[model samples]
Target: MTGSTVGGQLAEELQEIRERSGLSLAALASRTPYSKSSWERYLNGKKPVPRQAVDALCALTGTSAGRLLALWELADAEWSGRARPVSAPKEPQVPDRPAPSPAPPTAAARAGVRWWTVAAAVAGVTAACLAVLAFVGGSPDEQARTATEPPVRNHGCRADTCEGKSAVAMGCGAAGMITTLATHTASDGRRLELRHAKLCHAVWVRATGLMPGDRVELSLPAGRTQSVTAEGSLDAGRYLATPMASGDSRTSTRICLDVPDRHPECFTG
Candidate 1:
C-alpha cells in the first residue's frame, strides 16, 4: 500500500477500535501516555505512528493483536517496501519460531553518531562555556554574547534539568525563558499579539508594539508561545519582554529558550 493509503487505513482502524471500546479520544489518551492531539495525528495519519503506540492501543481496547499487527505491517511497508518487496508481510504474524536477540549498533551508527547529537553536544559545550563566563566576571563582549544567544530547549527535564523532586509543584514544573531579542516590523503596521508559557510561576510579559486585545497562549512542556488575539495598530519596530519560570530546581533553573528563525548568531552566542 502507498504511504497515504496505509496511514489512512491504520488511522481508520484505530478510530474504529476506539469507538468499539467506547473511549473518547481524551479518555483513551488518559489510559495511555500519548496525548490527545497525538492520537488525532495517528488516526489522521498526519505523522507516522509508533509501534509502541499501536501496542498501547491494542492493550487498552482489548483488540486482537494479530489484526493490529497486520495494520502496523501495512503502514511500515508503505515506507520500507522495495521494488520487489521482502518477505516481511503487510501484517506481521508471530510464527511458532522463536525470535533471535538483536545485534549491537551497526558500524554506521557508531561511526559518526548523528548530526543532531553532534550539534546538541556542541550547544551544550557552548552553554557551559557561557555559564562559566557568566559565573566569572566576563567582559562586556562575552556578556553580550551570552545575553543574545538562543536558548537550547531541552525536552526531558526529569533528571538533567530538574532536581527529580517527586512533588507535583517541584517536579511537574514548566517554563519558557528568553534567549534572544529581535527587532521586527509589522507589514501595514499592526500590533502583534504577545504569547508566553506558565510553568510554576506565572509568566511576566513585557512587550512593545502590542496594543490591547492581543492574545497570548503558553505552550507547556516545550514552552512554545503563540499569539491568539490582536488589537491596536501595529508599529514597524517594537520590543517585547516576558519573564517566565518553572520554579527553580537544584538540577535545573531556567528553561531552554527557542532560537528564532534567522538568528544563527544568537544561537552561537
Candidate 2:
C-alpha cells in the first residue's frame, strides 16, 4: 500500500465506522473530548492519525483493534523502502523508532532486585493517591448545588456610597460551572453565576466592590459584551440587571464553548 492510499483508507474506515454508529461529526467530537475541527482533519486524511486516536476510534465504533493494527503495519511497510506483499515478513518493529521500554516486573527488573520493598511502596502510594482524590473530587451534582447557592454576605445592597450610605443588600446567588476545564480562573477577578435549573434562561451578575468611578465591562466567548456600572464601592456586590443570551459572548475569550442543549455556567468575562 502506498502512503497516500493507506492514509485515505484509514480516514474512510474511520468515517464509515462513525456513520455506522449513527453519530454526527459534532457528536463524535463530544464523545472523544476533542474539538470538532480536530475530528474533521483526521477523517479528511489531512493529517496522520495518532495510534492512540486510532485505538479510540476503533473502540468507539465497535471495531476490532487487531485489524486496525494490521492495517497500520501495512502502511508502515509501504512507507519504507520495501514494497513487500501485505502478507510478507511482518516488520512490527519499525527501525526508525526506538524500541518501547519493557513492562516492569520483567526478568531484568526482578534480577537480583528486592521486589517486596517496591511492592509495599507502590501500595502505600496508591492508597494515598486514592484518598487524596476522594477528598478533592466531589460529585458533580452536589458541586453544582454548592456553587449556585447564594454567596454569604455580611452587609446590605444600596446604590450610593458618596452620600455615606450603609445598609445590607439582598440578591440572588450563583456559581459558575465549566465542563471543559477542571478548574478555571477569572482573568479579571470576576465570574458569573446562575441558579441551576432545568432550563436557565439567563444569569444575574453584580460587582461586589467598585470605587466611586470604577467601571467594568462583561465579555463572554464569541464576542458578547455588556457594560456594568459599579455603585459607590458596592459593599455586597452588584446583581446583573438582565439575563445574558448564549453564544459567543466575548470576542477575546477562548476558554469555553457553548455545547448545544447543555446548561452552561456563567463564564468569566
Candidate 3:
C-alpha cells in the first residue's frame, strides 16, 4: 500500500485509541508533550507522526507499541521509498578461450580479489541501511521516556516579549509577518486591529479592552468566519484564522462584538 494510505490507517488507529481512552484532543495534548493543534494535525494525518508522539500515545493508552510501531514502519518505508531493494548489476560476459596452464597468481587473481572487495563494500552498504532503518523505527521504551519529559519552549520570546512579533519571528513557522493592515474601535470602545503576517498568509484580530464574557467574531472573505470568547477578563487577546486565499479581494475584514445589540466593526486596509 502507499505511504499515505498507511499513514491514514495509523492516524485512524491513534484516533481510536484516544477515543477509547475517553480523552479529548486537548486532554491528550496535556498528557503528552505535544500541543492540541499538533495532535489535531497528527490525528487527521495532515502531518507525519513522530516516534516520540507515538510513544506518548501508547503510554497514555496502555497499549503495546509493537503493533503501532509496525504500522509506522510500513508507512515510513512507503513514504521514504527506501524499502525497495536495489538489484545488483550483472557481470559482463567475456569470450570463451582455451584454459591456460596452471601458473602463478597474476592479473586474474588480482581481479578476483577486487571482486571480493566490491562484494564486501555492498555488504557494508546493506548493513548501514539496516542500521538506519532500526534507528528510525526507534525503541518504544525510549520514546515513552522521552514523552514523559517536559515540552521544549522557544527561548527567543516569552509571553512578555511575544507581543508585536510575527509568529514566525517568535518561532512559530517560516511564514509570518508583524505588519498591521488596519485598526478600528468596536462600538463598545474596544480597540480592534487587523494584522497580517506574510509568511503565514493569514490575518489575525487583536482586541483590547475586552471583558470576561465578551465574544469576538471575525468575518472574512468567501463567507468564512471564526469566533472566540474572552477568558479571565484579559484586556487584550489575539485570534488567528485560516489562511486567506490569494484571490480574495475584499477591501476590509469585519469584527463583531456580541453584546446586547452591538453592531459589527470593520477594519479596512
Against the unseen true structure, what C-alpha lDDT does each candidate score?
0.45, 0.43, 0.59
For model 3, what is the error of residue 22's alpha carbon versus the real structure, in angstroms, after optimal superposition?
1.2
Those runs of model 3 whose alpha carbons end farther than 4 Å from true positions after fitting are 1-4, 84-269
What is the per-residue lDDT of model 1 for residues 112-135, given as tens digits with 9 covering 90 to 100? Answer: 555556666667777977788678
Clashes per candidate, residues 3 or more apart or on different chains: 8, 22, 3
Candidates sorted on TM-score, descending: 3, 1, 2
Error of 2 at 76 (Å): 4.5
User: C-alpha displacement of 151 in model 3, angstroms?
Assistant: 11
The residue pairs in collision within model 3 are 175-199, 175-200, 176-199
Better of 1 and 3 by TM-score: 3
Q: Between prediction 1 and prediction 2, which has the larger lDDT?
A: 1
Q: What is the C-alpha RMSD of each candidate to the true structure, in Å?
A: 24.1, 22.0, 16.7
Candidates, ranked, lDDT:
3, 1, 2
**Model 3 / residue 163 / CA error / Å:** 33
Instruction: Give the per-residue lDDT digits (tens) of candidate 2, residues 29-147.
Output: 54443457867887787765544456556645656666776775554444342344433222234356554766445686654354565556667776876786589776433443344
Which parts of model 2 are misplaced by more than 4 Å?
1-4, 76-269
